[model samples]
Target chain A: MTKPDVLITGSYPEWDMQPMQEAFTVHELAADASATSLPRDVADKITALAMKGHAPIDGAYMDALPNLKMIANFGVGYDAIDVEAADARGIAVTNTPDVLSDDVADLAVAMLIAQARDMMGAEAWVRSGNWGTQGAYPLKQKVSGSRIGIIGLGRIGHEIASRLAAFKCEIGYSSRSRKETPGWQYFDDHVALADWADHVVIALAGGPGTAGLVSKQVIEAIGPRGILVNISRGSTVDEPALLDALESGRLGGAGLDVFENEPKIDPRFLKLKNAVLQPHQASATAETRQDMGALQRENLLSFYAKKPLQTPVNKTGKSYPR
Target chain B: MTKPDVLITGSYPEWDMQPMQEAFTVHELAADASATSLPRDVADKITALAMKGHAPIDGAYMDALPNLKMIANFGVGYDAIDVEAADARGIAVTNTPDVLSDDVADLAVAMLIAQARDMMGAEAWVRSGNWGTQGAYPLKQKVSGSRIGIIGLGRIGHEIASRLAAFKCEIGYSSRSRKETPGWQYFDDHVALADWADHVVIALAGGPGTAGLVSKQVIEAIGPRGILVNISRGSTVDEPALLDALESGRLGGAGLDVFENEPKIDPRFLKLKNAVLQPHQASATAETRQDMGALQRENLLSFYAKKPLQTPVNKTGKSYPR
Candidate 1:
């Protein structure tokens, strides 16, 4: 019998896929290809699929691959994948989470500090030789002792709070339920959180449930002197509302690691001086990506060996214990 | 009886000099006049003087100002002033040192994290829309768990170490004397410190003693993967050697807040993408500057009250150990 073929749709450390390649015949997609552009004929021969956040693994794609048995996602968020359809077809879907929490948390704090201090602006000022004429630029805001509000207190949010605690920030959070954590104050509504917070972070998962959670009311509540940081999915925020707040100076600044239409960011955001923009790379650190790749490889190997797969996303959809 | 008039050669917070004006008849100099070009008769009437770092308070000016009593320097590192001449004439000199320590430490850490993560480069890349063409950029070095070497573990150095402790970076130091501290390793020489550390920070004091401390040998020891951060005086580093190291890739990256001929930075440094340059603004925060102004005013008030000054420059000309 021909060995079961696996199709990998995302980039990972080459060594991580070596073990999976040894176990089965593998076809790797070009790093730049969109999900729809992958060769359709090859899809029929695929027994397992491997992918990252960018690829949409919906029911339509699942229908094309009749022999597909399982999917091992490279990172935590599976919002791009249609899990309900995969579940209906008895396809085991696994995601790599928890391994990237600390790395993303670090990036969130770095972005917050960078925005508060006007680091990018300062660098440009110095490089342009403005310092020679102006002597030294004016000072920026203080990061420590600022009031920080977290929108969602999930794994990554909690990690960010833990790191920020060391900086002496007052941590407040808005979540579905109140947490009994030591230093975190819980608020049930986003407006209340924004009204009190000097810095607001959107860390909610992206999906229909969380779409447009940060409305114009919340942005207005944050006020001028307040900074917004988004490391979570772009759909969680109202982009036009955020842009309006920034333009009107109702919001002091923003540090964005993700966008509503990613890879095609809103052009209006480029004109704002108080914004710090990054290419959705919160969890793109070498160590975190390596860990994610290793976990994804393990999930693929475990399924082939007829063992219980770790970090199953289909289980979450079924309301099973994760 | 004639009143002893005070002369201010540089700009100050209006409030800072109001108290001084009430105490003594104050004379303000033209803002743009070169210190060397001040009228001879105006210089003759000046008794107590207030000045910023850029003004040349040298031996020639000291000789010209016959009635000069005290030189209340506005900021730390009074390298522009001729301290030895002032000491010889029994003219007391004071600087706002400790007041700026925390602010400078904040910038040092900011620069360290910014440079290590290629934050400025990444920001520019995103703003220019190059990110879409370049999928995900490769990771720079990690800040956590990296070995950091600090030269001259004075107040600013200590504060930086304490702040970085939260990030879990292993701290090492090279100073004039060995000091005992938990989790801090002391190296007698900078070369050994550079050999052991992946990141080297120059926080040593300026003046003749520390001139040329970070020689070519030290730069070479801190091999290709090493990052260098200079928050200390620019004279401490040999810029030509640093440029050579950067060109040869012997040094990984650098974040420089001060330079050898500041305001006239070496044009070569401007051409490098790996270096993050600032206009000597380690203590440029508004809160820190306000504290410094208040401290300078207190020191002046104490001197007039015939009490010991708060931060008098030592007889040997060092500003430490207030």
Candidate 2:
């Protein structure tokens, strides 16, 4: 039997491919290639595609890949890929989810603490030699016992909530539907949750459905002395409106791992000292990245061997069924 | 009768002095004067000296102030004030201890987490635009659920232990004498404690007595996977030896709030990415600092009234004598 041809379109640490090479006939895509950048000839023959976070495998690219059997995403959040387009082509979609929950949650909390206490600003103050002549400046904001609101109750969101419980924060959440969980108070409305929470965290799914879900009204409800953290999709928030809230101090601070434009973040955000900006690195820890790569390879091998895929994207509902 | 003269040696925030001024004849010393830098002429007439952290009140200064009845310290450690000499002269000394415990403990945990995860380095990577091209690097060390060794289990140490308990960390400690605390394993020796702990924190008091408590042997025992956090006093750890450990990567990372020759940290420390350096600001939050200033002023007034000081240094025993 001919080995399944897998086109891997993400840069991984060199050691990551050792396992991939052992399992399949792997084709290395150009380091900078988006899903659209694949050559026409290669797209026609590719049996599987492995994608990274930056690449967008939209409808146009899905239509071009005639032989693609599966798109094994290297991380959680398949927003970059049009799962509906793949579904129309009868191609399976898989994501590495549970493996990254702890790591992403770690970064989320790290960013929250870093932003809340102005850790970065404090470090800079000391390094700038102003600390010696001046005593420490007034404290920033407090983190312990603050009211925290989570927007989405998925695997990663639940992990963040569990970790935050140790800090004595009151945890409140808003999901599409509520399920009973100890220590978590569910809110039926996101805007109402913002009004009551001191820190509003965006951890919802990334798709057209969730796009702009956290609107200007929700941000205004967060009011002053409130913080916003986004570890989920950037599109879930209205970036320009959020910026206005920050400028006016309607929101206290933000720890954003995802941005509307991501690698090309709003330049205005650079001017805001209260914002802790990251390059969409919620699951970027070494252990988690390696695990994500390994999981992707496992998904591919399982599909080839006629075994069940571990984490399919379209588990309960049809992807964009119309 | 004329009100007793109170000399404020350390600068208190304007708001901190309102209550004290309403009750005493206050002489404001220059806010920026270091203990050693106070003019001899000004020192001659001081009836009571109000000092803050690390403001040296040595024998020479005390001898100059013939009318000095008390030295009221603003924060916990009075290493700069010679307590033994003050006691010999019947000059009372007091500090604000328990009030700053929670705030200082909060900072200790923040520094520990920041150092273990290389937060400073990660933030710099993102801000410098290197993260997009380089991707996220391996975190320096682990903090959660790790074996944590604490030296000096006093109020602040106990506070840190309570906070760490919530994180599920295994707690081990070495103090002057073994004390019974639930869930805490006491080690008779520092080296033995270091050998077993993934992170070693120095929360011991500062003075001639603890100048070099954490020596090379103890640091070596901590090994390559170990982290060291010092929020107590810079004199507790041998700075030269710590620099060597970090240079060789024998110790994973360090989060320091105090230094042996503070405001003059070893330049070698600046070169290391694993070190999270803060300018001795453990109790530097606004609320804590204000509380400390107010407490110091209150202690001075109490001395004027021939009343007992609130938080006197324990020169003779395990606990402060009333």
- The per-residue C-alpha lDDT of model 1 at residue B67 equals 82
Error of 2 at B222 (Å): 3.3
Over 4 Å off, model 1: A1-4, A16-20, A29-45, A178-184, A308-310, A314-322, B1-4, B13-24, B29-45, B315-322
Model 2 lDDT, full chain set: 0.77
How much is the lDDT of residue B185 in candidate 2? 95
DockQ of 1: 0.44
Worst 10 residues of 2 chain A by lDDT: A313-322
Candidate 2 lDDT by residue in tens digits, B1-322? 7766677765566787777777667777654454345566655656787775465777766776777767777888888888888877667888888878766777788788777667776666667767656665553444556788999999899888877765568999999998778769999999999998989888899988988899988998898877898999888888889999999998878888787666766667767877788877677666667777777877766666666667777352112223
The number of the candidate with the highest TM-score is: 1
TM-score for chain A as predicted in candidate 1? 0.92
Give the C-alpha miss distance for residue B151 in model 1, angstroms: 1.8
Per-residue alpha-carbon lDDT of candidate 2 for residues A1-322, written as tens digits (9 for 90 to 100): 6667788876767767887777777887763565456677777778788877655777777676778878888888988878777777778888999887765776677788777767778777667776766666556666667788999999888877876776667999999999677759999999989988988888898988999999999998988777898999889999999999998898888988888866656777778888888767667666667778888887888777767787778632123122
> Which number leads on lDDT?
1
Error of 1 at A292 (Å): 2.3
Per-residue lDDT of candidate 1, residues A146-265 (tens digit): 789999999889877876766667999999999877758899999999998999998888877899899999998988888999999888889999999999999899999888767778
